[model samples]
Target: MTADSSLLAQAREWHVLLHSGRATAADRAAASAWRCTSPAHEQAAMDVERLWALLGQLGEQPASEPAAAQVRPLRRRRSLRWAVPLASAALLVLALWLPQGAWMSWNADFATAPGEIRSVELEDGSILTLNGATALDWTISEGRREIRLYRGEADFQVAKDSTRPFFVEAGPARIRVTGTRFDVDYDGQDVVLAVTQGQVQASDAQAQPLLVGASQQVRWSGERLQPLQALDARQQLAWQRGKLVFRAQPLSEVFTELERSQRQRVIFLDQSVRDLKVTGVFAHDDPQAVLRAIESNLPVRLVRLPGLLLVSRS
Candidate 1:
């Protein structure tokens, strides 16, 4: 039986809250009562738990191998281990998974794991390049072609078909184009569109269609589209070439990208350090090198932990 979307959302929210360190006993009691409301609610909660279990096993080795042989050596020489509690680890996983629509990722036609960049050739001769941790679903019919980007970023080199238009639904914005090359980045809260070739029409839930041409980009958040800004489209899309170009961006923004490409969680202990300006072109393949450079140039220190990295002000 299919669970209602609203019920699934509620179940996911409750799961995250229960796992979060901030949840109180009262919250747990309330969540239990919520699950008792209906059989659908209970099933939704079970589904959420099942998904969490699957996520936990993503890093595990095959069961055919002996457990003793599965252990691996630590990458860092520093013996400093942050005493992260079991609850905190669960919370961290949920924090990283939920925002990317874990449900959608599970059902996506195409998905790339963290730190994996993949290219797919469509039946229509279009080429799709998916960035790390991205998930998307697509359908190409005789009348039209539609792509729903649930999370992360993708570059599309659409094949020319004058009789059919390509439509991409990303967060609050929808893009319609015909035989164009463009990039779309959607991180749950915001949607960014950059056109590298030809022109595309982008619109949000409440905004009119905005024409974005080559070298132009626009951002959509809270159902509103920001003004078009001109940029070096090639520079913005350097990730396809194994490079990341940052120009005076916030340290938090830089780490977000690193988290995708490195498959590691980075937590900022001090909020003030997140706003530090960072500018440089770094190789995407060497996330540790980039972190070392940031540590050297910025007034910050790094603490390596198992599956996580902590940053704080010096």
Candidate 2:
């Protein structure tokens, strides 16, 4: 194997060992020493770790029978100690090489690539405006209409269809409405529902249904649904117009939202800097310029690199 490929393989091994909850002090020290060997080593480790997280969010499954059968041989042949290493390596390789469109096409009825927004018209007269990096599917049958928000955000303008109640399932929560305009944003963990017109009822795993009126928002996670808060729904949905508005939010969250607005990944190298609050209006057309503006105001430094943007405390 090439030197770079060898480094990536070693990085994957280190990643699995460290996260296995069985790493000894010596193992950690060895991993640290290996990372210090070269910048390439450190980058490889970081890339693999991030890719693992991304795959988890994208619902990565176990290896297929053929792939599993390949590992079975390493167990039988004691001399070939490549199973564990190859497993993690294979996952990282798939993450790196898999066509993102294929992954989305397999599951999502409709999806938008990173930095791309789209609009869809349901079988009913309802309209959906998907935000960047969003994926959703809908089922309409037997006087029932349901939409599932698998990732990212979307704004819905429901058609007045009282016969078939409209529902949106996001994460661990559900929003039920009949002919109402609202926005749903699922960030893998929490689902935020913002109503622009009319009202909707929201419920999560641990909470009863709650009513949310126009210009109000509610957040739901696996735990419970939060009480409604008043906010400008139009401002929240400004991403539809290539703009983003953050009101005294954490720098980390700002960067996270910025990632959804663009194609590249953003990494916060300094956790302490992330807690810094930021409030600004950013145009999504130029993410790099937005980062530059952030760096000018905050006590953080930004490093622009291909495929990754690194943030650290100044």
Instruction: Give the best candidate by TM-score.
Output: 1
The candidate that wins on lDDT is: 1
Off by over 4 Å in 2: 1-105
Q: Per-candidate TM vs. native?
A: 0.68, 0.67
Tens-place lDDT per residue, model 1, 190-258, is 888999899999998888899999889999977689999995655678888889888898998888888
TM value for model 1: 0.68
Q: What's model 2's lDDT at 192?
A: 85
Give the residue spans of candidate 1 off by over 4 A.
1-90, 93-104
Q: What is the C-alpha lDDT of each candidate?
A: 0.80, 0.76
Clashing pairs in 1: none
lDDT of 2 by residue, 226-264 (tens): 877896755677787788888888887787777676655
